[model samples]
Target: MFVHLTSAANAPRIRRSGIRAAGRGVRGVHCFPVLPSYTLTHQWVRELARFGTRGGLVAVHFRLDDAEPVTVRHYGTPGERTTAAEAAGRLAAMEDPRGWEVFLPRSVAAPEVHRLRRPPQVAGWRYFPGAHGRRPCQCDGCRVRGEYGGRRLRERLPHPLDGPPPPTRVLLARLAAAGDPGDSAVLLDLLHWFGLRRRRRGPVAELARLAGHPDPQVRRRLVETVWRWSSPGAAELLDRLADDPHAQVREAVADAREWLAETD
Candidate 1:
């Protein structure tokens, strides 16, 4: 499951920005692009229930940096329940389990997925002060003199490509069997792009597993990808790479380790 941390104002926009292989699915109830059905009231508690019933991948996009932090319940498969604090403690203890799940439309072959709806004209102004509502006042920055004509903005997933989501193992195998250096580079680039779009820890974790690739260049590139994703195990991965045999790989690892240390 993916957990995106963003401001409440931007949450709607972020939700609408579907991944590159865009597909349509409703959030929470029937996720198209795999976003959770969110509720401000008892938000975390509801998530726990959904996780139990849905029994698949889940994404929890929360705007929890408010004065009152959002409550989170221990999410589990069917028949398990726990307090929010307990759940938080458990999640915290676990290696950062990236909640984001990647799905390629053609690979997943979800017929239900459709093209994302087009956003309304001037919908971008919704966040500006005095940019909305049916009010008559001469604010210096009034985009709408009266009621806004634009349709209400809601999160939308991208149109799905035809097919089932590809298996991760298959993708990894393809990477291993890349026909040539160029093919391998392209595959790596695609996976890296996918990881960025999903914004989770799993892809980085998987990439870390390939750190021992015979190619120094590949290992060096992997360091940058891991650094960019900045997932839970990034520090550990860098620590392991600190003694890479190749000078270039070791240099990248050193830089990444320094960055992690400085940030921490």
Candidate 2:
């Protein structure tokens, strides 16, 4: 989420300028002011993207120094047809001296899943944002167990019909066996969870292989996951990844090295 926090003294002037700019009757323009040291949280970013769908430009002015202030302009476009290349070009043109950046929301194309038009005998899995409890068993193995355990116990359970989704575990195994870059983001999240769980098998080896993935994002995530795990040979592998051509990969490797050193 992006917050606009300007100094009280400059707020009036910024507001007046904003009003005058609005009066100009621009087809697609939105303007606001943000302060230094302000954070743009993930939730707010999602909200901003949702609110800025009117296919216009929104400017975010910021105070960088007493004499020079920075201005960032955000352009919101309609529909899901905008390409990343186009968005990058638009961002490049709005280069503001005051550390301004432009953001465009891009749609993610996910794999299609075929679901029955009518509900099946057994309901499929559904993910809730923050729900946690003793849900009903839904996995193949868990469903069998539930059948033997009795319907009364299953009905009284506080959890959903499906047990905890093990997409991470299943995907990690697939990545390890197949090395599919398509599952990189899911693998990264799984690796992070694995690191936290202190699991030293399966996904760790897959993540190690991904250190050399062609996708920079995948390689970067691998570096972070490896470092977070702090597995025995992770540092040595990261040393080679540190020299990766992609800036994101290099940065992740450097951060991992620093974290390792601090821990040691």
Candidate 3:
């Protein structure tokens, strides 16, 4: 089981459709695995509210299968691989789990919802735990740019090293279109970027060319792209990827097929 904290305003929609991503760009939902400490489980509630939740907040408790894969980590640190049950137990044993979180890379179905309950009105820390009376980091990398006071904070605490930002989408597309057979790094980035949005057009024809790419990883990403793609060519592409020789690629094909079926 896990608990997702969000604005109470979103509760109705969540109840109706379970807890799906708010936008196509959202990677997935972030929640803390249900810990023995209810406060620890709902630790993100207060921090989330600091960003301006219109109607306070609510907690959505849902369950995941033990064997389900998830990424667990402390805030601003790299995550480690773990199963859902392992993640829950690991956090449950911690003395302080304020900054630790579990990232579930998919939507939670309504049937998996255990309860929607109001947590303690004042639970969890405001900033990083153990960070009282210290100057909050003002670097662009440290502060959330779109939060409630983001603009004011950026103006107030500008960093000298934070130079002009690059146009991310344009450069990603440029690099992706270059199609260097050896540029697996850029291909991975482009594949992940494609997964961030739903495109019912254009992508299939372009990505289909990668079906014969030597890298099994590229073909695996191709399968994943088809998993969420809603086009005439998606099924045909999946059928082509269905025979990938690499075990991981074949496994990804299977998972993508399941996602497509569920979404369909």
Candidate number achieving the greatest lDDT relative to the actual structure: 3
Candidate 2 lDDT for residue 109: 15
Model 1 stretches astray by more than 4 angstroms: 1-183, 198-200, 228-232
Tens-digit lDDT track of model 3 for 180-218: 564777776666566545466435776777777788888
Per-residue error for 208 in candidate 3, Å, reads 39
Clashing pairs in 3: none
lDDT digits (tens) for residues 148-173 of candidate 1 = 33222111222233123456676666
For candidate 2, write residues 149-233 as lDDT tens digits. 4456555654442344455567566556654555667666565455444354334555666766677877776776666554567
| Clash totals for all candidate models | 20, 12, 0
> How much lDDT does each candidate structure score?
0.42, 0.42, 0.77
Report how far off residue 159 is in candidate 2 (Å). Answer: 14
Stretches of model 3 off by over 4 angstroms after superposition = 22-26, 137-264
Alpha-carbon shift of residue 55 in model 3 (angstroms): 0.4
